[model samples]
Target chain A: MDVRSRNHVTVTGRVGGPVVMLAHGFGCDQNMWRLVVPALERDFTVVLFDHVGSGNSELSAWSPERYSSMDGYAEDVLELCRELALGPVTFVGHSVSAMMGVLAAAREPEAFAGLVLLAPSACFIDDPDTGYRGGFSAADIDELLESLDANYLGWSGAMAPVIMGNPERPELGEELTNSFCRTDPGIARVFARVTFLSDNRRDLSQVRVPTLVAQCSSDAIAPPEVGEFIHAQIPGSRLTTLNATGHCPQLAAPEETAAAIAAFARAAG
Target chain B: MTCGTGGEEGGRERDNGSGPGEEEALFSALLEDSTEDLYEHAPCGFLSTLLDGRIAKANATLLDWLGYRRSDLVGRRHFSDLLTVGGRLYYETHFGPLLRMQGEVSGVALELKAADGSRLPVMVTSKVKTGIDGQPLLIRTTVFEARDRRAYETELLRARREADQERDRLKLLNATLQTTLLPPALANVPGLDVSAYYHIASADEVGGDFYDLFPLATGTWGLFLGDVCGKGATAAAVTSLARYTLRAAAVYDPDPAAVLANLNTVLNHEYNGDDPRFCTVVFGLLTPDADRGGFHIVLASGGHPPALMMRADGTADFLPTPGGQLIGVLPDAHIATATVHLAPGDTLLLYTDGLTEARTAAGGEDRYGDDALLAFIRDLAPSTASDTIGAVRVLLGTFGTGVDDDTAVLAVHVPRAGSEERH
Candidate 1:
């Protein structure tokens, strides 16, 4: 009970129907959901806040030992939900945040109504028998980690193109690249390692909430098979394939992507 | 207790009785002559600590490396105070347990903080020195310099990084060279479905795989996909020559079997010496037939895997082009030629053995075989060439980095009139 209770959170929606909370991926803040927030705010209450050590969030609240794992981020999501009095909320997440959402939802199923996962990759290394094709080889991941340690900006520049391979939606890649570059280099390195190396396929099975996995057709980072893997593992989860390519389908095909999410939420509700 | 009180009083009495205090004289001589020299010049650093890891005694050698006076370390700081953050964790996790279990432990490596907070790599040995009756006492610790070993490891890592860079540069160059060996774009043959995919096994080394569809004499089209035997610049050289020679030869002959024959003859004449170049090629020629609205295709094989024929009615089987010898091996190679009629909606898939020969798993000998490919083709028999190719692309992506060699697939389908436009 001695834990800090003075923590504050902001919630906003004009034409509220239900609540949808979003958590951003590694090296990014809550501002990543800006493009999709406008569309969601039209129909639902949207709750947005940065995790500690990121964006508008208080940096003084960050403790390296506490924030060492995604559990800290999960606690932030749960705390934000509790503070906002948001019950049975739809949680939208990207990359590592998607797994964090899964862990959070698994921990408290009554708090989370559903999950919207975009470019969710459990593990980046390839496992032959399981037919999971997360693009990088073991040595490739090692080189990636080493480069992250040596020069974070250089690593982001190299990774951005690979993650966003779609030539048509160049802006999506630009946004991702910018978001990655904006992160503090030291924190970015640790966050990147945690994101890429984290194995969350096991956590998928524990998610009892209704889940929507909107996957890009030609994403080099999270291929369709990865989405299929998530769909197969998570019970009662629906998989919707997007014609868009690259990791961030929201930036590429926001209208169609948003429509799918809305439909899923409506159906679940 | 007996030695401390009784010996001290007896030593005083003996000093009074003896002429020059013999035992005390010898003890003083050893301390003055040998102890300081031993402490200063010993191979390892000698230090004592309190129960709280505080330094009590430290040798001059350890103090010199740390840029500290002996008085600075002893009685002032704990042993953990000297360690870096990582070293402190190691001390808590591994060092403390082993020291507690055994009376002594040795060869524990750690980074010790110097006087200016700079790091000094060291190997520490510690022992629990006890009283004569095994009662608890102070801890004794020894540390050795790890400067040379740390330097060697750093250099080795640097060298490894350089080697990796060299390999990556070579891979980029090989990718560029491989691009040149194949046509920039295969000439779009009208009324025929065309889709080709190339899978490179290792980017660091170039594999010889060349495929092209070129127009020949008499309104015919000749296409071939071949793999040269070896790798690197040598294989790349042969690949370039073979690709150009096949195109050039097809322009002269226009017959699929004869085009391959001429290519074989040219390769035999050019690279038929010691350390000669050899490759397996499957050549196909498409020509309009008067009897049927479809095209008559003659496929000549030179020691290549059979081309799969996925029919319009959803049945799939391999084209019979057997008994072909590997090109460039002999002066007169036996070429196997088979003629097939490509009606509307029929597709022909030509590929290298790399598709079938890829290992499915680590420590697994199960190659993704001909039967699996047949089933895969069977699933897509009634599809357009482009859809077939797109599906195959997805399948290849699924194979991921497991396909340890290059794979090239060139498919030509005589599509239904409207179907060709969509494809």
Candidate 2:
């Protein structure tokens, strides 16, 4: 199997530079890193890819047995890294992908130089017994699933709007609107369950490499304490809060996000 | 009141300098009321929110529909507050990011939570209202009620699930029906080795291939393998009739040629119509040769592929049963017979054309033909009947999806004095 075609892997940035691979979370594809890729291109060899069954990745490759849990996604990440063969790369994972990176690095620590986890939560559902708050209730996650059903027919209509008048990059408007975050609903359901319900808190201590836990200052999804919790769990990990709002710091504050990734890759390499 | 009438008659028509008639005066009053009335009583609800999603204004229609007062919503509620918990998460993760990037979004369906805790299904369209400096200021949203549309979608989803269930049930039914057309197990013929295998090409559609082995009257056995024309329900019906008729006919006559002739007569009479069904079959009658220490077998064919023999001396060839006509194709179909002595360490195999016609990886144009099967068995000569059947099964597996039709094979071998037990 051609792993590149299966995952829709794309490689860009300075050739022969230290590798930095970016993995998108749920809902969106590789385009989630469009804002951050430019700043990192000067210093690192960047890699971007969509998870299977999302964006332009091969839908036929996705099976419920393999992708129902976190292991399936983590396997794809390791396979992608193996396929690239760009020795000892730094992985920059966002949202749910942070957990995937954790799983991948834990399984094969030698494959990675360092890890940058952005706006991540090890588990999304709150556990009352342990007093660990993962930001959402189990019932709240179900509601989110219901919301996905509501938009089943409305997805195309939502994508139909023309993205006009973004002053930063007018030429990119055509490509941006249709391609961003358009996921197959069936795959999206499995991914949503995997992203929100999976508990990777126990997997954190297994990391044997340098790790950076980057948090957004005002993210509704992963609050500041979640970042602190992750940092405390990992051995000798550093936590830094970005001056950005929302769950997506890469898009909200790209320059700062990219700079953090580049600085880490250089120092870790 | 003819308001367009001649000049001085305007007073009776109640025309003034400002207006022509009472209807015109009423229209003028309505025109003056429209500005505020249009905003408050529009068919769809409207809301204007700050860039941060705080509601700056809520139309009276929106407030009334949601069972909320103007003071209760405006300046206090965010646009997401009107949504259900699920809708709010969806709005934040997908809809909010889209609206922020796209500048405008439309026809997004979401369920709103009313003050009374009931659900209100709605479709919303929102556009960013940018200031003159080209920075986003606030959002202008229009909400359309979609109660009927949601009900319709729910019904559609339910219907799709039923169809999927029905399809799965049909496949299970097909498989059960297929098993009934063949013998549960081959009858154990003492002092002789017998083996059979049937490969079903599809689970959904029942294939038209069958084989059976059973005991006849006294110290004799009957066996046959055949392929009925076409596939699915109609072909399956024909296969069931052919298998039962061959068994009953063999019990009556025990002669290989006579048994097949009886089957042809039964089928030709039963299906004489335009959609007449037919099959190619090979039937065999085996009797133990007391002195020669092997069985004497007579094989008959009805437009079927000839049987093959793998000999004790490491050689293989097909037994020619020429001039046989397809059963049920004519009033009097000719049955051709070939006699062979099943010597020790010699195996005779009967099969349908599905075996030879199987496509091979050599390309679409190539088939694993009669010559290839002859050569393959020649390589495995001096083999037992059970071993030959096992080898054929492995060969068929190599074809994978190339074998589109069902295949049936039955092999009979006479073991040498000290040969290994039949597999």
Candidate 3:
């Protein structure tokens, strides 16, 4: 199988420079990075690819047994890196892909130079015994899943605005909603379960790369405490709280998000 | 009252409200009394919160449901504080942001924590009140009791989960029943190495493919492999009947061709109608030849794939039994017979069409046909029975989801003279 066709990889920007790979999260595809790409493209090589069940990637490549967990997604990331011969590239992951980067970087530290996690959560369900807050309970996750299964269109309409978080710019929310609606409903249901039910807390401590956690202010999806938890677990990691509000800072506040990432990438390099 | 005597004067008096002053006083008093009563004791709970989610004002009906005083909520607690932990999380993540972005959200299911620590299921609808400049000022919310809806949804979820469990149980039952149709274990043939494997394409549905290797009489063994016309209970019935009949008939005659003839007669007699059933089977009778120090095997094929033989000296070929008709298809199905000797270190393999007809490539347009199997066996000449079966198992795994049919393989090898103990 062609790895490029498998991931629908798109590479642009300065040649022979440092490569910055952008991986989108669960609901949207690589197009979610549209606003943030131009900022880094001036100096760095920007690479973007959708996960297999999202965007223009081949739908036939989806196998339930292969993609039952995040490990399979991590394999795709590593495969993409190896195909491009990108050595020690910088990885920028949004939402669930943030954890994918963590898993990849932990397993193969030599493949990544630095990590930028945007609105990432190592776990989504709250663990009462540990007093750790993941912003959702198991029942809430169940309700969310049921809502997705019952009326996917209504769920998309109700959830896209909440995830995008900018009332002033309704177009952003509209775009996010459209992206959610465009996805295959069955794949989206499975992907949603995989995303929210996953627990990568133990993988956080294994991240050896220079990591930057960029959390937005008042983000309901990933609370401030979750960001602090990630920063604490990852040794020598920097935590920067952006002035932006909501779960998606890349779409909500691109300039600040890009500036923060660029500053970290330059320093890490 | 006195003006009623005149027609135009009485009409003017009534129109100007001079005739019924007492009745007008009662209607105005009723309207003034009900306005406040409506807000306080409405059917739904009503609340207004500050921009930061703190409670600004709550209606009397909401306070009564939660068993809280107006002072306890207003100016003291946030609206999120009244929700259960999970509901609070959902409110913060999905509800609050949606209200901010869309200005309103409706029919969101949530649970509110009451004063006594019990949970109240409610459906909430909230709207962000905006200022003159289009900036959000506060949030106005309506809460409806959803006890009936919650109970119904819970029942629905429970029923769905039970149905899933029941389906899994049925699959297990079918699998167990399918296993019973085959031999528990191939009879231990002294001085010979034997192996068999069954590849099931689906766990939910039972396939009609079956195989067995069992002893018949002194110094002779009966081995047969077949695939019934269809799957599920109907084909399974035919498969069981054919397997038992073949075993029982071999005991009476011991000739491979005669045993298959008996099965054809029984099937043709039992089913000769619109819903007729049939199968392709190959039966083999093996006997030790003391003079040659090898085994003499006679195979009878009834529209089955030819058996492959791998010689000890790195040579492989198929023992063809052509011109045979499918068993049970006719009154007297033609059974073709072929005889071969399994010398020292030689192996013979019998398999159903599942192997040759499997989709070999990723596109699934091509099959792993007879020629491909011949070539594959040629590469593995001089192989033992277990080794041949293991190699085929690995190849089948590579085919992944393309192999949409059940496969049964049986191989028997006569070990070299000195290696009988190892075999």
Question: Which model scores highest in DockQ?
Answer: 2
Candidate 3's residue-wise lDDT over B114-181, tens digit each?
A: 89987788878888888889767888999999889877766776787688799999899889978998
lDDT (0 to 1) per candidate: 0.73, 0.86, 0.84
- List model 1 lDDT by residue over A1-269, tens digit each: 21122122446664457787766665456655665777877887777766565544555666777677877778777877776665678888876788889989999888887999877877766778787787656565554444333332233443333223356878865664554344555465466566667778888999998999878776555767788999999999988888865455565456777787777766665
Worst window of 10 by summed lDDT in candidate 1 chain B: B92-101
Judging by TM-score against the true structure, name the best candidate. Answer: 2
Ranking by lDDT: 2, 3, 1
Candidates, DockQ: 0.02, 0.44, 0.10
Task: Give TM-score values for chain A, per-prediction.
Answer: 0.81, 0.95, 0.89
lDDT of 1 by residue, B122-193 (tens): 767788877899644777998989889656655765786688789888888988998988788888777787
TM for every model, in the order presented, reads 0.54, 0.76, 0.65
Fnat scores for every prediction: 0.00, 0.53, 0.05
Clashing pairs in 2: none
lDDT of 3 by residue, A208-264 (tens): 999999998867679999999999999999999999866777766788998998888
Candidate 2 on B146-225: residue-level lDDT in tens? 99998997777678668868988989998899989988889998878889888888877999999888999889999899
